[model samples]
Target: MKSKIKAAFNPRTWWPKAKDGMHNMSPLVAFFLLNLFLVWIKTYINYLVNFNLGVTGPIQNFLLVLNPIPTAIMLLSIGLYFRGKLSYWLIWIFNLIQSLWLFANILYYREFTDFLSFGIMGSGSATGNNLGKSIAAIIHPTDYLVFLDLVIILVFLLLRKIKIDRKGIQKRYAILTILLGLILVFVDFGIANVDRDGLLDRSFDNNYIVKYLGLNEYALFNANQTYQQSNTRKKAGPKDLQKIQQFVKENHSPANVSYYGTEKGKNVFVIHLESFQQFLIDYKVDGQEVTPNLNAFYHDQHTKSFDNFYNQVGQGKTSDAEMMQENSLFGLNSGSAMVKYGASNTFESMPGILGQMGYTSAAFHGDVATFWNRNNTYKSFGYNYFFSKEFYPNANKPSYNVGYGLKDKIFLKDTAQYLQQLPQPFYAKLITVTNHYPYDLDKENISFPATKTGDNTVDGYVQTAHYLDQAFGELMDYLKKAGLYDNSMFVLYGDHFGISENHQPAIAQLLGKDKVTDYDLGEFQKVPFMIHSSDLDGGIDHTYGGEIDMMPTLLDLLGVPTNNMTIFGHDLLSAQNPQIVVFRKGGWVTPKYMKYNNHYYDTQTGEELYLSKDKELAKEAKANDAYADKVLSDSDKVITGDLLRFDKRTDFHKVNKKNYDYSKKATLKALKRSQETNPSSVLAKNDGHSTTDEYTTDAPEYSSSSK
Candidate 1:
C-alpha cells in the first residue's frame, strides 16, 4: 500500500511519462489549454489589482481563481465545432473579446467603483461624451496586462512557431470539455453559496456578484437579465399598462384634507440622509447627542416627524429610496430602476408633477453623473437640472470627494452657490453621502469616539453619523440665514440601515442585548423621516410608513392629486393609509405581525410563532404574505415592462430626454439663460446678489472664503 502511494505521488517516475504525454498531445487540445490558462491568469490579475472585490479568507480566494476557468472553457470550446484555420481564428476572436472585457471593467471600476453591466452599456452616452480625456484619466500602465497573453500569442502566430492542426476536434471531445466546464461552473456556484448564503440571490451589489462569480460569468448574468427585461418590455402592451393602472387606482389612499396643501408653493428641499438609521435619532454617545440638528428638527414646533417610519429599499438601496420618493413606485425586486429602467421608463415623478406647477426642479448629488445611472434617470423624472460632481468646484480633489461623494459639509456649502441661483419654489433634492458604508471619517472631522463594541463596522458608523449631523446643521443654519427656511419646506430622512446584519456580535453589544436575532435585524430597517416647515405644526407621530409614501405625502401637503398617476404609497398623515410595511426582500411588518421568509413574529414582542401552532396568527401571516407578494409582483410588472410608456394620458407629459443635459458647462449655461428669461430664482429675488454666502459651519473643512 505504501509503495503504491509513493508511486502515485513521486514526480521522478511520472515526470518522464507526463512530458511524453504532452509531447504527443493533439494540437487542438494544446491550443485550447493554452488559451484557457492565459485568460485565467489575466482575469485573476485584474481582479487583484483593479477591483475591490472584498474577497476574504482562503476559500473565497480559491473560488475567485477558479471562477474564471469555466467561462474560458465554455467560451473557447465553441471553436472546436469548426475546422483548421477557421477554428483557430474563431478561438482567437473569443479570446480577444474576453481580453477587451477585462480591460473595460478595469477602466469602469476605476471611475464608477463598479463593474461593467448591461445596464451601463445600454446607456453609454452618459459616460461616452468625452471618450478621449474621460477614459484616458482612468487608464494606467498596469491595465495593459490584460492583453499580454493575446499579444504574445499573436507574435507566436506571426512567427509560425506554433501551427494550427488541419483537422477540427472530434465531437465527443468537444462535448466532454463542455460537460466538464459546466460541472466546474456548478461546483464554483455551490462553494460560493456555502461561503456566503444568498450572495447570488439577495445581494444586489455588482461588486459582490463579480467577486463571487467571475467577471465573465457576471457579464453573462447581466446579459441574461437585460435580455429578459428587454423582451418583457417589447411584449408589453396597453393591456399590461391597464392592469397596472387598475392596481395603482385600487391601492391609492385619499389624502387627509386637514393637512392637505399645508405648504403650497413652498420651496421643497429633500435631504437624502445616506445609510442613516432610525435608532440614531435620539441615540447618545457618552454625553453627546449623535444627531443634534435632526433631533431638534424631530421635536421642533414646526416639524412633523414619524417615529415608526421605515425604508422600503430593495437591491437598489439608496437609489430605490429615491425611486420610491420621486415616483411613489417601488424599486425592482432585483436591481435599481435608476440603473435598469431609468433610460426607458416614463415617470410621473415628484419633479414632473411640480414642474407642471411652474416649479423648476433639480437634483443635487456629490458624485459623478454615471453613479446609479442618475444622469439619464433624473431626466426621465423630468428634473430640469441635475448638479452632479461636475458642477462642484474642485470636486476631483481627494478632500472634497470622499467615500463615493463630496464631503457633506463642503457639498452643502458649495451647493448653496447653485441653490440660490435656482428659481423660487423650486424642488431640489440634496443627497448626502459622508455617512455611507465603511463609515470612515477624516481625523480632523471626527467629533465622536468609536464605540467599544469591538466591531470596526459598527463603531465607525457613529462618528460618520456625527459628521453627517454636523453637515446637516450647517446646511440648516445656511438655509435659515438665507431666509429660505421660513418659506421653504425641508424633508430630512434616513435612507437605510448603516450597519449590515453580518456584524451581529457588534450589533448585539451596541444595542445592549444578549442576542441579535433575525427579527431584530428586520426591525432595524427603520429610518427617520421628518417634514419641517416654519409655519407647520410639529410632532412625533407614530405613523408606520416607508420610503414609498414620501412623494404622495409631500404632494398631498402641496394639494396635488395623484389619482391620475400610478403611485404605490399613501400619505402617512391620512387616516385611511394602510399600516402595512412592505420590505423588498419578501418581508412585511404591520402593527401586530411581522413576516420574513418562512418565519412569523409578534410585532410588539420579538416572539417567533409557528404557523402550525396558531390558526389565527397563521391566517394573518398568509394573507399578508399573499398580498405583499401580489403588490411586489405587480410593481415588478410595471417596472420591468416599462408600461408607463404606453400611457397616453394628457395630464402628464412624456419626458423628452433631449431637453435636458447634466454636464456642468451646459447646465450652468442653461441656468443662466433660464434666470434671464424667467427671473424667478432666489438670486433674482435678492436683486442679483447671492444668498449662498450666509451659510456657516463649525466643520473643519468649512472656509469663510467659500461661496
Candidate 2:
C-alpha cells in the first residue's frame, strides 16, 4: 500500500523519466511543446500582418506577441492524454487546426478587417454557399505559409527524422502545463487592462480585444459573448423592453411635415447597389466618367440624393447595412446579427410593418438563398416572396455567374419578368452583385477603361462599376416600358464601401491625394443614397446620415409614425434628427466634427483637433461622443437580447415562418394565385403578356439560358 501511494505521486511512474530539466521531457511532452511553438509563431505573424489591430504603442506591441502563448498551451495540451502514436498524431491534428483557424481569419480580414466569431460557426448554413471560389479569390500565395509547419512535421515523420512517441504523459505534468498557461493568461490580462481600461467589459471593437490579448483569446471571448447573447435572449420577457421603449420615445425623430405620407401606397423599389461607393458618382478618369449613367440619375430632376450619406456597417458589411435599412437597428457589435439571430430574433422590419397595409414584400438576389443565410432570414423579415438563384435559369453557369453571383446585366434582364408578376404596391428589393470585391469582368464586357492607380484591387473597380451602371440603365428602361416607373418610388443606395482601408495607397492615387488620413477615411465611408419618384420635387439633400436612417425616412414619407417602435434611427428629412452619423466602431462623423480612432478631426478642413487648445469644440465633441455611444450600446442590447420580440404596446404577431415558402414552384404558384384574386400586377395590368422582352442588354455573354 505504501509503494502504491509513492508511485501515484511519482512522475516517473506514469511518464518515461529520461533526465532532469532540459532533457527531462518525455516524447509526449516534447511533442506538445513543439506544436504549441509552431502555432504561436504562425498566430503572431498573422496578427501582425493580417489582423489590423492598430498597434499604437510599445505595450500593445508587446502584448500582441505574447497573447497567443497561453491559448497555444491550453489547446495543444488536450492531445497529451492519448498514448503511443495516437498522441503524436493528435498533437499534429491540433497544430493543423490552429493553423487552419489562423488562415481562415486571414481570409476574413481581407474583406472585413475583422476576426471570426462563434456565430459564423454556430450557424452551419453560413458555409453552404459557393465559399470555395470566394476563398480562392481572396487568398494570397503567402497565406499558404500557415500550413508550412504541418507539412514539415509530416515530412519529418516520413523521413524517420521524428519518432512517434510511444509513451503517454503523466496527468500531473499535463495539469501543471495547463496551470502554467493559466497563470500566463492572467498576467497577460492584467497587462492588457493596464494598457486599456475596461479592456474586457466595455471594448465593443473586436480589434481592441485582439490588440490587447490575441486572436485565439478573442475567439474564446467571442464564444462566451455569443453564449451570453443567446442566454440573454432566452431569458428576455415583455418587462425587459421598458428601457428600450423609453429610450426610443426620448430619441425618436418626428416626421417631416412637408414629405410625410406624400408617397403613400406607391410601389417601393429598393435597388441594392452592392460594393458601390459614392466617389464613383461623376468621378471622371482622364475626363471620362466612370459611372456616367448613375451620375445622370443622381442629378435627375426627380431624384432626392444625399451626398453625405455614409454606410454604417462593421464586420457584417453588406448584411449589416441591410439590417440597418430594414429594421432601423444597428448590428451586433461582435458578429452579424443577420447571420446570427436573423432566423430566430423578432424584428419590427420594413416588410412586417408594410405587410399590415397590404404590401406584398419580396426580395430578388442573384446569389443562392443561403449565401448569407438569407433563406431563413427573409422569413423572419415577413417577406411574402424571395426570388433567389434557383429562380434565375443560368445563374449557375460560369458565364452568368462570377465569384459572388450572377452577372448584373443578365440578372437585371432576367428579373424584369418576375417584377411584372408581383402584386401592386409590392416592396421589392433587387440586389446587384457584378461590382463586388475582386471585381472580375470578362474582356468582352469591359466597356470602360480601368484606372491606372498602380493598385490591382482598385484598377478593375471602374470597369465593373461601369458595367453595373449599364445594367442599371437597362433595368430602368424596362421599368419605364413596363409602365412600372412613374407610379413607383425608387430607393437606390450603395451597400458598403467598395475599397477597404487595405488598399489605401491605391485609393489615394485614385483621389489624387498623397496619403490618406483617418479623417479622409472617415469621409471615404460615404455611399450614394438617392430617393427618386417621377413628378416629386427633389434635389441633392446634403444630410449627414447613415443606413440606420433608412427605415425612418421611408416610413415618414409613407405617412407612418414610429411611436411604439423600438428604433435608433432619425428620419433624414426631419429637422429634429441629430445629423451626427455614427459608425459601428465607436466613432462618429458630424458636419462640424469627426471622431475616429479615439481622436477628433475638423470635418470641413480635415485637421486634427487638439482638445487642450480648443475647449469649446472639445465640449461639443464630448457630448456627441456620449450620445453616439449610448445610441450604439442601446441598439446592440436590443439586437443581442431580442428584446423587440417582447414589444408590448401593440398586439402584432411575430412572423410565422411556416407561411413563407421560398421554393420556386411555391413562388410562381403564389404569384399566379394572387393574380386570380387581386389582378393588380404589371402582367395582370397588361392583359397577361410578358414584359421581359423590353429589357435589352449589350452584354457579350447574353444567351437564351440567361434570358
Candidate 3:
C-alpha cells in the first residue's frame, strides 16, 4: 500500500520520462511548431503589404504580442516529446527546409520575379544594378529578419543536440518541457481570443498581424469600423437623380447639337500609349527635334491638350490606368484591385457599353494578352476580339531586350487593317508598347531625326514615340482614304507618365531646365486627347477633365443614356461644377487652382492646402475613401467568383430593400455579371473566348522591379 502511494505521487508515473531535457517531445509538438512558424512568417508578410513604413506610422503595440506564444509552446512541446529523435539529422533537415521556406516567402512578399533578368552589369543609373539596389533597400529589414530568425532557430537546435545526454536527465527534462508547453498553449489561446468571437473575428486579427507586429487588436477594431462604414452608402435622393437626368438630357440630346458627319453610327478608335508623356512633344535634340512627327501631328489635328493633367498611377500602374479610362473607376490604395476583384466581373466597362450599342469592340496590344491578366479582363469587358503579339506573325523579334514582342508600328498597321476588315461601327482599343522600358531601339533603325547623344534610353524612347506618331498619322490617313475619317471619332491618351529618368531628364535639358517643375510635371502625364473631323467645327473646350470622365463624356457625345451608374467623373462639355483631378499619390488638384496632397494646396503659391473649419474637406475625403473602399470590396467579390452566378434574371429586390435604390442594385448586379463573365474586362481586350479559358489566364506575373 505504501509502494502504490509512492508510485502514484511520482512524476514519472503520469508523465512521459526521458533521460535528456528534450527526450519527451512529440511529433504533434513539432507539427504545431512548424505551423506557428508559418503563421509568424505570414504575419510579417502582412505587415509589409499593409503599410509602407516610409508612408504609414508604425503598427500599434498590441498586435506584436499575439504571434510568438504559440510558436514557443509548440517548440517546447516538440523538444520534450521527441527528446531522443530531436537530436537526429532529420531535425536539421526539417530546420533547413523551414528556413528556405521562410526566405522564399519573404522574397514573394517583396514581389521578386524569377523570370526577369536584371541588367546589373550595365553602366547607367537606370541599369539593372541600380534598380536591384533600390529593391534591396526596400525589402531589407524584413528579409534580413527572416534570415536571422532561421539562423537562430538552426543554432538553437544544434545546441540542444550537444548539451543533453544522460537518459535519466532526458526523462526529467521532457516532463518539465511538456508542462511548460501546455502552460504556454493555454495562455496564448486564451489571450488571442479574449475579446474575439468565432474564426472570422480571429482571422481579422491574423490580417492585422500582417500589417504590424503587436497591433492586431487595434487593426481588427479599425477594420470592423471600416467594414460597417463601407456597407452604408448614402441614398441618392430623387432630386439628385433628377438633376443628373436633366444634365444628361440638355447636352446629349441628339437634336441640340450640330449634325456633323461624326455621328452615333461612327466607329471609335482609342489608343492607350504605354507611358507616353506630354514631355515628348517638346523634347528637342541639337538642332533637330526628338518627336517631330508627334509635334507636327498635334499641331495639325484639332487636339485638346490639357496644360494641367495628372495621372493617378496606383499599385496596378498600367492596369489602373486602363480601369480608370474604360470603367470610369478610381484607383484603389490597397494593392491591385483588378487582380483582387477580377474573378467576379463586376464593372460595366466601355467595351460592354459599346457592345450593347452595336459596336464590334476589339482590343490590340504588342505584348502577350496574359501579361496583366488582360485576356480575361478584355473578354469580361465585352470585346469581340483581341490581337496580341501571338496573333502578329510579321512582328520583329528583338534580342537583348527582356520584353520581346511586336513593335508599335506593326501593331498599328495590323490594327488598322483589322479595323477595316471588322463589321462597320466598331470600337477598337489600341495599346502601344514601343515606349515601354528597357528602351532598346538601335540608332540605325531610328526613323526620327536624333538631337541627343550618349543617353540611349531617352533616344530609344524618342525614336519609338516618333514611330508611334507616324503610325497614328498613317491610321488617320487610312481612315480618310476609306471615307471613315469624317464619321469616326479618335481619342488618344497616355497610359501614364514615362518611367525613364533618362527620358524625363533629356526633355528637361532640351527645355533648358533642371526638372519639369510643379504643374508642368502634372501636365507631363496629360497627353493630347484629340478629336478631329472634316465636318465638325473643331475648337478646344478648355473644360477640365480626367481619364475617369472619358466614359461619361463619350456616352454624352454619342447621345447614349447612362442609367443609374455611379461614375466618379462628369462630362467636360457640360456644366458640372468645379472639376477635380485626383492623383493616385492621394493628391486632389482641382481645376479651380487648388492643389491637395493629403492636405490642401494653393496652386499659385504651392502652399499647404487645408480644409474649411466646417469639415468640407473631411466630408469629401470620407466620401472618396468610401468610394475607394467600395471599389476594393466589389473587386474582391469579382476575384473570388462571388458574381459568377449573377445574371439578368437575378433579383435586386433584396439589395434595394437595404436602402440602395433599384437602379444602383441593378447596376451592381450587372457589374457582378461582367466580372464573372469577363474577369479581365476592365483592362484586357477580350477575344470572346470561353469563360473557362478567360479565368485560366487570370493569374498575372508582376515585374520584379519598378521601371
Candidate 4:
C-alpha cells in the first residue's frame, strides 16, 4: 500500500509514456493544450496586476480564477475544423497572436492601469508614438513567461521530437470541444450570477466583465456592444427621441425661484480640480491647513458650497466628470464616453447652450488635447477655442510639467492670455493639474510639508492640494485684475477621489476615524463642488449632488430652460430636486440612507441595516433603485441609440461637427474668425489685443509671451 502511494505520487514514474496508445498526444491536441496553458498563465498575470476584482468569497474567487479557460478553449476550437498542417499552423498562429495580445495589454495595463478599450485601439495612431517610447518601462521580467509554451513548442518541432500530424480531429471532436467550452462558460456564468445577481444584463463595468470573463471575452463583448449601439443608432427614429424627451420632462425638477437665473448673463468660469477630494478642504495636518485658499473660498460669502457632493465618475474619471458637468448626461458604464462615442454623439452642452446666448466658449488645459480624446469631444461640445498644451508657454520644458501636464500655476498663468482673448460672457473651463495621482512636487513648490500619517501618498496629497489652492488663488487674482471676477460665475469642483482604498487606512487615521470602514471609504469619495457669483447668497449646503447635476444646476442659474434636452440630473439647488445621488458603481446615497451593492446603511451614522428585515426601508430602497436604474437605462438608450439625431422640435440644435477643428492652427483660426464675426468680442474691442498680457506670476517657469 505504501509502495502504491509512493508510485502514484512520483511524477517521473507516473508520467504518461509516448509509447502508450491513449497517453500520446496528436499535434492538434498538443497545440490546443499549449494554447490553453498560455491563456491560463495570462489570466494569472492579469489577476495579479488588476486588484479591483473585490472578490468576497471562494465562489467569486473561483469564478475569476477559472474565467480564462473557456475563452481559450472557444478561441482554439476553430482549429479543430481545419485539416492537416493548416490546422496545426493555424492553431500555432492563433496562440502566438493571443500571447502577443495578452503581453501588449499587460504593458498597457501597467501604465494606464486600465483595460485596453476599443476607443484606445481605434485611436492608437494618435497615441502610439508616446506609448511606444515608454514600452520599456512597462515590461516586467516575468512578463516573458507568456511565451514559454510557444518557445517550448517551437524547440520541440525544430528538434523533430514532436512531429506535425497530418490528420485533424473529426467533426465529432470539434463539436465536443465546442460543447465543452460552452459548458465551461455556462459554469462560469452560474458562479458569477450567484455571486453578483444580474451579472450579464447589468454588469456595466468593464473590469467586472473582465474579472468574470477573460480579456478575449471582454473584447468580444465590448465589440458587440459597440456594433449594437451603432446598429441601434442607425435604426433609431423620431419616436425614440420623443420618448426620451418625455421621460426627461416628467422627471425634471423645477428650479428654485430664488436661485433661478441668479447668475444669468455672467461669464462662466469652471475650474476642474484634478484628483481633489472634499476631505482636503479645511483639513489640517499638524495644525497646518492643507488648502488654505480653497478653504477660504469654500467659506466665502459668494460661494455656494456642497460638502456632500460626490464625484460620479467611472473609468474615464476626469473626462467622465467633464462630460457629465457639460452635458447633464451620465457617462457610459464602461470606457470613456468621450473616447467611445464623442465623435458621433450629439450634446446639448453648456458651451452650445451658452453659445446661443452670445457667449463664445473655450477650454484651457495644459495637456495635449489628444489625451482622453478631448480634442474631438470638446469640438462636439461646441467650444470655439481649445487652448491645449501647444498654446501654453514653456510647454516643451519638462520642469514646467508633472504627471499629466503643466503645473497648475504655470498653466493658469500661461492660459490667462488666451482666456482674456475670448469674447465676453465667455464660458471657459480651466482644468488644473499638479494635484493628480502620483502626487509629487518640487521641493521649492511644496508649501505644506509631508504629514505624519506614515503614508507618503497621503502626505504628497496634502502638499499638492495646498499647491493647487495657491494656484487657484492666482487665477482669482488674475480674474479680479482683468475685471472678469465680478461679472463671471465661477464653479470649483474636484474631479474625483485622489486617495484610493490602498491609501484609505492612512487617510482614515488622518481623518480621525478609528478604522477604515466601508462607510469611511464612501465618505472619502466626496469631492468639493462650489458655485460662486458675487451677488448670489452663499452658504454651505449639505445637499447630495454629483457631476451629473452640475450642468442642470448651472443652466438653471443661467436661465436656460432644459425642457428640450434629455437631462438625467436636476438643478441641485432646487428644493424639488431629487436628493438621491447614484454612483457609477451600483451605490447610491439619499438623505436618509446609503445603498451600496443592495446593502443599506443609515445616512448619518453609517450603521448597517438589513434590507430583508426592514419592510418600510426595503420598499423605499427598492423604489430608489428602480428609479436610478431607469434613469441610467434611459440615458444609455439615448446615447447608445443616438436619439438626438431624430429631434426636430427641441431647442437643442444639432451640432455640425465639421464646423469645428482641434488642430493647434484651429485656435488661431477661431480667434481670427471670432474677431471678424463678433466685432464687439473682448479681443476685437481690445484692439486685437489680449488683456491677459498684463498678467504676471511668480511661477519659475512663467513666461510673458502670448505666442
lDDT of 4 by residue, 1-707 (tens): 99966755453442234545454556677677877787787666667664344555687677777887886887787887888767766677777877877787776665444567675576554455444644654466888887888888778766867656666666656766777889998888887777768866775556677777767777888788767766877788889878878888998898888988878888999999999989888888788898888999999998999998998886567878998999877877656778777878887788887887788889998988887778888878888778888887688899988877899988988788777667787899999978876688888788677777887556788888888988898888877877789898999999988876655568678788778766677777799999999998999999988889999899989988876677899889988888989877667888888876445788899998877788878898879877777777777777778776777755657667788876778668777776677675565776876777556566655444432
Off by over 4 Å in 2: 1-37, 77-92, 162-174, 610-625, 651-654, 703-707
Q: Name the top TM-score candidate.
A: 2
- Candidate 1 achieves a global lDDT of 0.80
Please, what are the lDDT tens digits per residue for candidate 3 over residues 1-707? 99976865564554334457543643334433564465455445644452322122222234344443333433434434443444433344544444454454344333321101111111122223323433443354655554564466566656763333222223444455556656654554454455332323322112233323222232334455444433423322345434433443442312223421234776787878777776677666555566665566455545544444456655455777787777766544333444434433445677777776666677787666555556666655666667766555555444311243566555655555445445557788888776665455655446666445455445566666766666566565655655566667777777776533214466566556676543434444565555444444445555556676677667666666544444555655555424666555434555544433233445555554345553765576555544433333343333233232232322111111122111324433643454455444322233433222111110012122311
Q: What ranking emerges by TM-score with the best candidate at the front?
A: 2, 4, 1, 3
Q: What is the lDDT, from 0 to 100, of the residue 292 in candidate 4?
A: 86
User: All candidates' lDDT scores?
Assistant: 0.80, 0.84, 0.49, 0.78
Q: How many residue pairs clash in each candidate?
A: 1, 0, 53, 0
Residues 95-150 of candidate 1 have per-residue lDDT tens digits of: 99999999988876664355666655654554344333446644778888778778
**CA shift of 570, model 1, Å:** 1.6
Best by lDDT: 2
Runs off by more than 4 Å, candidate 4: 1-38, 41-49, 57-62, 76-114, 125-175, 190-198, 451-459, 502-515, 597-600, 650-652, 657-694, 702-707
Can you list the residue pairs that collide in candidate 4?
A: none
* Model 2 worst lDDT run, 10 consecutive residues: 14-23
Q: Is candidate 3 or candidate 4 better by TM-score?
A: 4
TM-score (C-alpha, index-matched) for candidate 1: 0.74
Write model 2 residue lDDT over 103-184, tens digit each, in one string: 9989977866677787766554664355565567788899999998899898887686876666676676677667778988
